[model samples]
Target: MDDVTDRLAQLERDDEELVLDHFDRRDAWELGHRLAHVALERALPVVVDVRTPAGILFHASLPGATADNDEWVNRKSRTALRFEASTALLGTRAEHVGFDFFDQGWLDPADYTVAGGAVPVRVAGVGVVAVATVSGLTSADDHQLVVDALREIMAN
Candidate 1:
């Protein structure tokens, strides 16, 4: 997690001037496309959903991604928003909450998963958006793919 944080911080610092000033819709779309492309390159079917404070602005799913995966991605984004953490953290919380996490009502049916692969997109030191995620690879692989995608986006 420290690694991810460090990378994110570095990206923020690198893009500080550009990002601090604004987040453009075109940039978001370009980022989403780059992310999806990375997923495809990995041979993992993936769905990328970009959501701002207002609503979803971009969504893309590579071939072989299912409707279920799409739903998972959407829920993952919502979970990120509710927890103010990455979807991985939400998944951990769900595990701690146990099988009844859903039953106990501590988890939102649309905002919980142990499957991994989702991440929140933050700017200006605040998590103002999220990227819904689904990957055909292992959960860790999925997460890494998203991280790689984000890195590539920031590099640009």
Candidate 2:
């Protein structure tokens, strides 16, 4: 439990540092490909989706990923965009608040999910401009992959 807490904390920190100075359609396309490449490199079947507040920018379903994974991507991305936090973190928050988010019906489970893999794509001055999401791995792994890729993308 402590380890999980520690990891979530680190993810929060990483999120803070990963904000982009600018993000555009090209960035979204490139980032989506990068995420897909990373998943392929890891031999992980995944679906990647990037979206802005207005609409989706980039979406890809890798080999071995299914329509189910696409659904997960949609729901998880909704969770992140609405909360402006990672979906996994939202799950932890739901636990801390002593509420079963689904049972409470606070959000329509059909449209939103508290599972991991969705990350808000924040801009340094503009707030969350989009979300970079990956589905089909453990929540923690999904979160870490986005964070790792963002770190690399932002650093260069």
Candidate 3:
């Protein structure tokens, strides 16, 4: 398969896995720390956030992250939760459809955005109950950071 196709497939797998994985406050803390650790190791300046449908569980802003990054995180998280899909996937789909998400979908541009970095946090047989988000990198890179951290968290 082509690189783009392969990347999409991997993202699909990751979305499914992350959705099925069980999580609670403890898990949220662990996952958040793990994300931060990796970002620090890579020297990536970013903001990480984890939240349940009901409330936020964790949030952090690393070096170089800005208030604007926090706004993007909110927008991206809303997109993922509303659609029950990763923002990265949504971004890709929007590009394929010629950027019609706002006009065609009847969603307000101010409230929701299909940018990358936000992913639905779900549990097996429970469906999506939270959102995990990172911002400050390219869309693909931000999405991959969360996916990679979740993969590592689930493997252990």
Candidate 4:
């Protein structure tokens, strides 16, 4: 948890706008949908996951998002659990640790492509509590959509 916090803090320092105002499951879902729609509009597949106190609260797969992408979401969720970090961070950390979190096990068998496009949603100062991710596009583009969606959602 400290590691997660430190990383988030670093991100906040690097980009003050990265700080989130916090949100609940409903808001997360709405934001996730917005992100999914954006990815779909670009003809890129997207997958969204909203974690809640009761468990995962919502999931959506846009057109062109493959079954493998769904599986990668699951894997990312699991990895998030293991690391006590956001799925996005977990994927990044995995790469730093010399393992491609998105290319192992079921992910490799599927059309899973992991590079970017995952974000952790947090309730202000509470740390990461959910994740929104997209696939089927360049990792950079996927990540940009997630970031843009969050910015839009938070601005509203």
Number of the predicted model whose lDDT against the real structure is largest: 2
Which lDDT value does model 2 have at 97?
58
lDDT of 3 at 87: 89
For model 2, how does the per-residue alpha-carbon lDDT over 34-99 read when each residue is reduced to its tens digit? 999888887898898999878999998888899999999989998898989888888866665576
| C-alpha lDDT (0 to 100) for residue 145 of candidate 1 | 65
Compared with the true structure, what per-residue lDDT tens digits does model 4 show for residues 42-150? 7666676666435777678777678877776665555444444444444555555677644546454233333455566655677667666666566556656777777
lDDT of 3: 0.85
Q: State how far residue 104 of model 1 sits from its true place (Å).
A: 2.7
TM-score of each: 0.71, 0.92, 0.90, 0.66
Kindly list the per-residue Cα lDDT of model 1 for residues 45-109, writing each as its tens digit.
77777776578877887888888777777667766666555655555544543545477687767
> What C-alpha lDDT, on a 0 to 100 scale, does residue 99 get in candidate 4?
72
Residue 132 error, candidate 1, Å: 4.7
Model 2 has an lDDT value of 0.85
Q: Residue 147, candidate 4: how far off, in angstroms?
A: 1.5
After superposition, which runs of candidate 4 have C-alpha atoms over 4 Å from their true positions? 1-17, 84-115
Tell me which of candidates 1 and 4 scores higher on lDDT: 1
Compute the lDDT of residue 115 as modeled in candidate 4: 45
Global lDDT of each candidate: 0.62, 0.85, 0.85, 0.61
